[model samples]
Target chain A: MKPIQVALIGLGTVGCGVYQTLHIHKQRLEIQLGAPVELTTVVIENPDKHMKIAEKTTISTDISDILYNPEIDVVFEAINGKEPAFTYLKQCIQAGKHVVTANKEMFAAHGRELKELAQKNEVQIGYDATTAGGIPIIQTISQLFRANQIQQVQAILNGTSNYILTQMRDHQLPFSTALKQAQKWGYAEADPTNDIEGYDAFYKLMILSDLIFDRQPDQKNIRHSGITGITDEAIEKAQQDGKRIKHIASIKYDETGNLTAEIEPIAVPKEHPLYAVEGVDNAIHLKADIVGDITLTGPGAGAFPTASAMVEDLCLILSKQSAPIPVS
Target chain B: MKPIQVALIGLGTVGCGVYQTLHIHKQRLEIQLGAPVELTTVVIENPDKHMKIAEKTTISTDISDILYNPEIDVVFEAINGKEPAFTYLKQCIQAGKHVVTANKEMFAAHGRELKELAQKNEVQIGYDATTAGGIPIIQTISQLFRANQIQQVQAILNGTSNYILTQMRDHQLPFSTALKQAQKWGYAEADPTNDIEGYDAFYKLMILSDLIFDRQPDQKNIRHSGITGITDEAIEKAQQDGKRIKHIASIKYDETGNLTAEIEPIAVPKEHPLYAVEGVDNAIHLKADIVGDITLTGPGAGAFPTASAMVEDLCLILSKQSAPIPVS
Candidate 1:
């Protein structure tokens, strides 16, 4: 069988992680795909920084190097932002390359357009790593739960925020202390506003909402609040009530099909699945009409977990087992 | 597109559920598959008992009715036991019909033979409902976690056993009383020995073991114990220690590839995911080399949850997205 030529479009944390995962699991992937998955090229902003990591793969600073290459059957885009990543991915899709991405923010905003473009171009786009990392929630929702009407989703999606909240609850620390601890542990970025302000979870929530409901809510109508305002008193009160304060992202449809979505802190009782999802782990609890209730809990962030999700997508694409974009 | 002609080879609890699910979701399925999924025929042991439920579909007492019908593309086997279920499924696969089964007992004993037969005949076999109902564990392990080396799987596999244990702990009842309550609620069969003796969980565990490890352990080497030995004192002791007595089906591989599997009552602590899994809800916690720890929890039994899994298999087959038998 011909090898599946693959390219990497970034060399950041998740990008490097994907590179290492592909390298380590190359033979295993070959056996799974029944075709070798070769990482033929790597695109970095600065080729100088990724020399050792790039290894034998051709390194280029230009996205066009991969975008224009007919041999590159798949591109894994690990860039973080909207502007160039979106443009590069769009061009890659148009070039007939199947794309797998970890850009949650960009996907949340422009996933519909990208999916439509991919469909028109007769290529596949995978964003499993864009949501709850390693959870396989996207594939589960799209494939396994395709026939069921998913009525509600409650999740702890952002690892940084979840880690911070776990620290606060476990050690009885203040929010600032927990944030600092999370930062030191590499769970939080320098400017943690996106996570602490609930925007990170909100973006992921939007991605899931789009996949499950096939529509995004009006931005202004969606309610969201961060964990920045979760006071020490509130945490103490929750503890006293035998509950854990968690940053929960939730979406539910009413009896009349009206959608309500929000990202905020909730005092979760012990009976709830999300209450036990501690530390940096993520959990998604889905309530569907046929299947009743199902919950998936796993590592929500980090390099290997994200790479695991991306590789699973690659496997699906390679084996021609990937589900169509759940449009309904 | 021509409708995918399908057959159901049983009209028991699960068979009726599959019929109802396929009937109710026919249009939704058509929209998803881009083709109609028509239940053209059903083969039941007693047509007299199922005429009302059979509705518009053809019902037959003979298995050859479905096996010989070239128009039938997929066959869902919901029969219990090994004799006819295994023989009928073998002939169906020989007839070039894709087969999906909910028979854990038969699958545990002869799944490998059936999968090999399906592969040789160039057809697909889906057994998602053979194990945990509606949790999607089989698909998750086969597809998402294919690359990762699953080091261990700890699961609550039997709903009847779990339901009885929950009642015993919650109501402080003896094992026999709990067993009676489970039967009264239809969670356990009249001959509840299979469930209470851990054989049900053992069979399901073996199925998972085969899927994940590609080999089943020697039946004689397996260690299995029932929840029948649990006394009121044991439940009280567990409660005092802030633990729950859960029937855990566990399989693990050593570094040297030695496999150890067992089904027994375990005193699960508060931190364990299985501790939170209450009543008939089943949970599987997987430890893999790459993704670390992941847990899937959902309704493990009942008509809808079991049918939900079978229908998902149907959807996969209809869309040509069903995963190949994981043979690594």
Candidate 2:
């Protein structure tokens, strides 16, 4: 079997994590995929910062190095934002390379266009890390839940906001104090605008909405509110009522087929599955027609968890390259 | 595209559910699979018991009805126990037919042999409904968790047993009273010995052990116990300490590659994920090296939930018969 040549387009937290994971689990992945997956190129803005990786593989500052290389079969985009990453991925797909990415913001905005392009180009695109990390909700919905009609999905998507809310409820601390604590623990970014203002959760919700409902709602119609405005008194009252104020990203379809989606805080009762989900854990409670109610809870974010989703996607794509392996 | 011909054996609870679900969701499944799936035959013990289903397809008491029909691409076995099911499935595989089964007892005893036979004959076998009902743990472990090293698994595998335990703790009922209530609710069979004696959970656990550990433990070496021994006093004592005595089937691996497995009533603390799993709801908490701790919870039994898994497997098999579909 010929090796599947791969390239990396970033060296940030998630990028480094993916590199380390693929390096550590190379042998096992080869065995599962029935082919060798070799990382041939790494594209980064600053090659000096990753000298150790540079020694093992070619580190280039130009995306064209991978985009023009016909030998590269797959490209992983781990950079944040929607600009150059989108353009680079588009070129890669046009160049007949399968692409896997963790850019949630870019995926939320331009996923439909990219999917259509990939379909036309006859290549596959994977974005499992765009939604809840390590939960496999995308594959679960696309494959396992294909036989059921998914009614609703209530999810705790953003780990930074969830961490802040948990801190406030557990310690009775103010919002600012909780934010500072989350930042210190490396859960929140330095900017923290996207996470604390609910935009992060909104993007993930859009990704899931597109997959589950088969269409995306207009951006202006989605009602979203961040946890920054949540008061300490509100948390205390919910606690007194034996409830927890959780930042929930929810989407539901009514009997008439109208879709309703929102990102806001809800006081969840003790009986609800999302109530027990604390700290940085993310949980998705999905209601469907055939399977009834199902909830998947796991790490919402982090180096290994996010990379784990990406690697799983890569393995699935590679496994399809050969004869189908029965997984019964 | 040619329609995939399917056969169902046994019109019991799960078999009937699969038939109805496939009937109702035929159009939708056809759209997803990119091919029509036709129920061409059904093998039953007594056709008189299922006249309605018999009216729709060929109903025969003879196993060779499907085993000899080369047009029958897939066979589903939903009967209980190991004798006829194992023999029929082995013959189906040998005849170059893919097989799906929900016989946990049969799977536990002869899964390895059946898997080997299927592999030798180049046929796929699906047994997702054999364990955890609609949770899709088998697919999750085989596909999504392929990138990680799974450390341990703690699960509530039997819905009848868990339902009885929940009634015992919540209503302070004795074991026998709870067992009667479970029977009345259709959660337990008339002969509740298999469920109450923990053999049902034990069988499911062995199936999971085989998949995760790549081997099965000797039945004599497994430490097994039942919920029948638990008294009202034990439930009260655990409740006083903010704990619930859950029937937990657990498997773990040490650093030296040794395996420890047992099925017993455990007093789980409030912090444990299984502590909140009540009634017929089943939950599996898996700890893996890459993705960290993950939990999947849903209805452990019932016609539709179990049928949901079987149909999902059917769709997957049918989908694979054509070009590979990218699920990302």
Best by TM-score: 2
Task: Return the TM-score for candidate 1, rounded to 2 decimals.
Answer: 0.96
Model 1 residue runs over 4 Å out of place are: A321-328, B321-328
Q: Write the per-residue lDDT of candidate 2 for residues A14-74, one digit (tens) a residue.
A: 9988998888888988888777778899999887887377365889999889988888988
Candidate 2 Cα outliers beyond 4 Å, as residue runs: A325-328, B54-56, B325-328
Task: Kindly list the per-residue Cα lDDT of model 2 for residues B169-260, writing each as its tens digit.
Answer: 88999999999999998999999999989999999999999999888766665789989999999999999999999999998886766787
For model 1, what share of native contacts is present?
0.57
lDDT of model 2 at residue A288? 93
lDDT, residue A83, model 2? 85
lDDT of 2 at A50: 74
Model 1, B201-316: lDDT tens per residue? 99999999999888877776578899989998998998999999999999987677778898999998988878888899899999987778999999999889999999888777
TM-score of chain A by itself in each prediction: 0.96, 0.96
Q: What total of clashing residue pairs does each candidate reach? A: 0, 0
* Structural similarity of chain A in candidate 1, as TM-score: 0.96
DockQ of predicted model 2 = 0.55
